[model samples]
Target: MRSLFFFAPLLRPHVKRFALALLLALVTLVAGTALLGVSGWFLTATALAGAVSFNLFAPSATVRGLSFIRILARYFEKLVGHNATLKLLSTIRQWLFGALFPRLPLPDRSLRHGDLVSRLTADVDALDEIVLLAIGPLIAALVLGGAMTAILFALLPEAGWIYLSSLLAAAIALPALLIGVTRGTGAALVEAAASLRAHVLDAIAGQDDIVLFGRKDHTAIRFAEAGETLSRLRRRQAFATSLAAAAVTALTGLAFLATLYFGLSAFQAGTLSGPILAGLVFGVMGSFEATNAIIRSVGKLGEASASAERLHAIATLPSAIREPLRPVALPEGTGIAFEGVSFAYPDGETVLDGIDLTIAPGEHIAIGGPSGAGKSTLLALLLRLRDPQHGRIAIAGADIRDVGLADLHARVALLSQDSPVFFDTVRNNLSLARPEATDAELFAALKTARLDDTIRALPRGLDTVIGETGTTLSTGQLRRLCLARTLLAPAAIVALDEPTAGLDRETELAFLNDLPQALANRTVILVTHAALPPELALRTLTLAHGKLEATV
Candidate 1:
């Protein structure tokens, strides 16, 4: 419940829309109660006074006006309510994305991709009940119930106590009971749904591997178990909601009977006329409409509370890296220095130990080593994706820690070993690094990466939409496309990890031969096992057992 209050700040911007929607909803309920009351009184009076004696014109006109107002108010109420809810959801998604950026490379690697997706999509969607189902409806019910009780007390004193007690029981006590009964089940239902979604996504992503390994049946059984768990929790929540609804119905019936009994006694004593008693009774029944909505949706209030807690938990997580209070400007020059740098993973596996190295501006160097030798970790430290546990890295004689992350990132660009080729057009993929780059500039980058010819051969050329992870392109072409993106970044220092991985031997050799010229004035740090041509005139180093050694 406390977590649900986290959204109050976000609700401020949309207050006007929400207030107007609430106003329209109240008008709709009030007009509906009046319509039912007037129609009951008009029909009885007309039957008693015959066609000529009764004044049908005034009562009929009043009923028609109330009905018209109810219809218009109901329509606008739905319109404004849904519009405001959707706009608020849009704002939340934007806020979540904004909150997510700085916390990238989240410390907790155990958080699966699918579970995160569920929180962002399904959990966020559930919050709509906060306004549409829970808050707005609850407010409307209270206002209508209070107004109806006041009218009964003023006109039909004997029945007012019965009506007020019944309204309080239905609107307040019943929903509270429902929430208490269903809270745990509601939260479990949300978790079970997210788990099921994660299993489905995992199966879809690993379908090929499952089939190849002959584990399809095992995977299917796992999925079935998750589905069953979700179904069981849903059934529990539904059963609780049904019981609450039944209680509300029973309460409504008893209240109606009691109000009618008291009203009849008053009429017998000549304190209340038949037409007025009928109107009051019908009004009492009409007022319970608000309670019905509140009862039916109380279960979702539990679900919304659980969803808010999950979202709040994720948004408030401690960031993996903290920005400095006052950042120093990156000095001129692209030279990089690693002075006695050492790093270890959270599991205490030392990747780099007491490593000292330096590269002058515009120098091209290649680092080679066996797998798991920490060549990649060095690059990550330089980019400040993860700071070293010991010593410091400097750029142009200034400690990189003192420089702003954005400034340091702009000064250096990296094409990692697992760099992704997004599901987008050839032009769009390349333009990610430089959105305002010209078609000519894009073609130049693609040509340098030796992918322009393949793209040109396609019917749509740069406009061709690639499949997910570039499934439409050959593995080598995909690698080259990602390479072109990295090359397009306007940075003085560029790091490429296994950039020529999927290229054939011929293409690999050709790319390496032309690499120096393609990156003429930029400092290049290449981490690969590929043999470099002597003509490239680049220094070569090797990393082994957490130490850097000059290659002969």
Candidate 2:
């Protein structure tokens, strides 16, 4: 319901355009109905005269002119409608991205890659059809229906009553059944399709890993299930939509039969002129034809509702992290303090509890712990990736939560366990850390990571495409590259996660030894399993469960 309300404002800017287009549609509807009535009258009049209708050429020419005007108005309506849809889609997507995402804190990737893309494209497209095609036409149909009833009544009151009754029945009943079923099916179909997209994309993206792990068959089975689910939903929706259309078509036929039978009776009684009877039947039926458009318009709303729900689901998450409205500044040289901080991931046992620690400015703090001992969690708190449920963390004299994330993030740079890489040139990958960095500054950091020589040997050198996730580079090399990028930034605090976790003795030592020089005056927090360089850290601590224990 919020989603529907949110979208209402999107139409305001383009209201004028929609208004003009609707006017054009009304003009076209009137002209088309007039043509149908006039054509029928011409035949009936000829029959009555027992000769060519008086002034046949003049009537034909006038009818032709009206039709030509109607054709142009129809074209104009279509043109404006398309433009309005595109504009509405752009505006709505902008809202979904800008207003929604910040409130949703997805610490981990929840949506599948392709499904995420589909949300931006296919989902929006579905809603676009509903907003432009469905909403606009429904309004036009109601207006046209009233006008058509008036025209029919003016010619033949009984016939007008019959046509209006049939039209109302078809218009209400068909959509109530079709779109009623459509609302549930559209959401289910969209969910199944999104699941399918996400599943297939994950399969493809993780194909190598799956094959390596020998889980290909299991993955394949899940993927097939996803495909089948989507297909079944779509098939069910199609069947229901068709059934409603058939009902509408059947009613339409009954209305036409009634008009024919009654017209013959009225003519025989000499209560109705043949020409007037013809005009009433044609004009009334012509207006009722828009019932088809009404059903189509109404059907799409169901799909749009489903799409809106999906978007709202992601948008209205219980955000784990919140930014300050007015932020305080971090102190110079980054003294870090964690004051009895406690936290746990949502729906999980406590990951960190009663954690208290402090690191003076320019100090190298090496944290060591067994796997799942909350060493990483402590680092997370410092970076404010995960906020504390209890206590406070501070940068010098100010609480970390008091500072806005944008400012806080700029002060501290963290290199996590996963050294993620993009499918891009090496230069741009490094630039992700600092987009405005100079080539010389980038090269200097690469040199410190011992990657400068390796990059120089590449075919494209610094500009070489690394493929997605830097497939061209080995794992250790990717880590070094990421480290280099993070090192390039002039953050007040630099935190490295298991910097030497997978590297060999030689490379690991080289990196560890150079890290201090690379960081210079910045406070360093290193999360490692092994002993850190004694010269770098003045004090060492171990994390067991969630407590921080100091050791000599």
Candidate 3:
């Protein structure tokens, strides 16, 4: 229940619409039971009246009015209820995305992409059941059931007691039974469903490797096994729901029979009219329609709870870097200095130790070393993706931690080896860097990266759709496009991590020759293992054994 309250803030904005929806649902349920009870009484009363000068006008008019009310109220009720639910879902999804976006370079790679996809899509989708299936129906049942009890009590006290007790028992006991019997099954189904999605997505994403390695049969068998497991879990949940439905139906019959027995006694004692007795009995029977919702919803309570817990866990994960409570303004210059900066990973491996370095404004420097020499780690620290454990990094005199992340990012742009290109049009992908950039600016950046001609030769030029992760483009083209994206950013600092990683020597040197022109006044931090081309005259530094030293 505490987990469910996490959405309280999100629901506040739409409280009015949500309340109206619930009220409509209550009115619809009341109209349904009232229509049933009144029809029973009208039918019985008319027969009695016919035996002694029947007055059909009043009963006929009342019945017709109720029938129209029932039809119209039910129609509007469904419309409003569904609209509120959809709006709530939209709010929840937006909130979930906002919570997860800042934690981008997730600390753990083992938390597979497929699993996150499951949480973002399927798990978030399950939250709708909380409002629509559980809370809404439960409230309507209570309100309508109470009104029915009051009407029955006025007609016959004994009949009212029987109806109220039976309805309450079915509402309470049946749901309790459903939760007890199906909680584990609900949790199991959710787990199996998520795992199955992960395996299927992983399999599809790696289909090429599986086929090339002749492990297609092995992959197929694993996929089938996962499908079978999910199928079995779903079947268990279905069976439990069916069982609860059957139990609720039986309880409905028992409540009706008990009401009739007491109602007949009242008729014999001359305390209740025949029509009134019949009306009370039918009202008792029809009220269980609300209880049916409670029954099915309880069966899935465990699933909703599990989903809520998962969302809460993700929303509360510790950020790899912390922001300041009172952020100071960014300083005038973009020149960066790392003072006594040291960082160690969770596994106790020190990636950067006692590092002190400074790059002046508009200076171009290349950092070269073998793998695991902390070149990339330095770039990460400079970008503030991860904060140093022991020291402060300042930009132009103020600590980077004192500066707002957005302001810092606006001043520094990174172009890395594994930079992502989305499955979108070339213009849309490039626009991600600067959404308000003009066409001329975009083309200029592309030309500086030497990718303009490649895009121009394409059938749609900037509007062409690149496949997922730029699969349609060659490795060199993808890297160049990423560099172009970096160039589009209006930043004073550009950090390139192996920018020419996959290009041939000739192409790498050509791009190197163009770098100075593209980044004329920006402070540049180039991290690469390759030797710098002498023509570029870049200051060279080599990081070895956790210390920085100048190279030839």
lDDT agreement with native, every candidate? 0.87, 0.78, 0.83
TM-score of candidate 1 on Cα atoms, chains taken together: 0.92
Clashing pairs in 3: none
Worst 10 residues of 1 by lDDT: 129-138
Measured over all alpha carbons after superposition, the RMSD of each candidate to the real structure, in angstroms, is 2.6, 4.4, 3.6
Q: Write the per-residue lDDT of candidate 1 for residues 248-308, one digit (tens) a residue.
A: 7887787678778988888899988888878887888888888888877788888888988
Q: Give candidate 1 misplaced runs (Cα > 4 Å).
A: 421-428, 450-475, 501-514, 529-538
Best model per TM-score = 1
Each candidate structure's count of clashing pairs: 0, 0, 0
Ranking by TM-score: 1, 3, 2
Candidate 1 lDDT (Cα, whole model)?
0.87
Q: What is the clash tally of candidate 3?
A: 0
Off by over 4 Å in 3: 44-67, 107-110, 208-229, 268-273, 326-329, 338-341, 353-357, 368-373, 390-392, 422-428, 451-478, 500-510, 529-536, 540-552
Q: Which stretches of candidate 2 lie over 4 Å from their true place?
A: 20-35, 38-78, 107-123, 201-221, 265-280, 324-327, 368-371, 417-490, 498-514, 528-544, 547-552
Alpha-carbon shift of residue 80 in model 2 (angstroms): 3.3
lDDT of 3 by residue, 269-369 (tens): 89888988777777777788888988877877878877777788787777767778999999789788999999887778998899999889999999998
Error of 3 at 551 (Å): 5.7
Estimated TM-score per prediction? 0.92, 0.81, 0.86
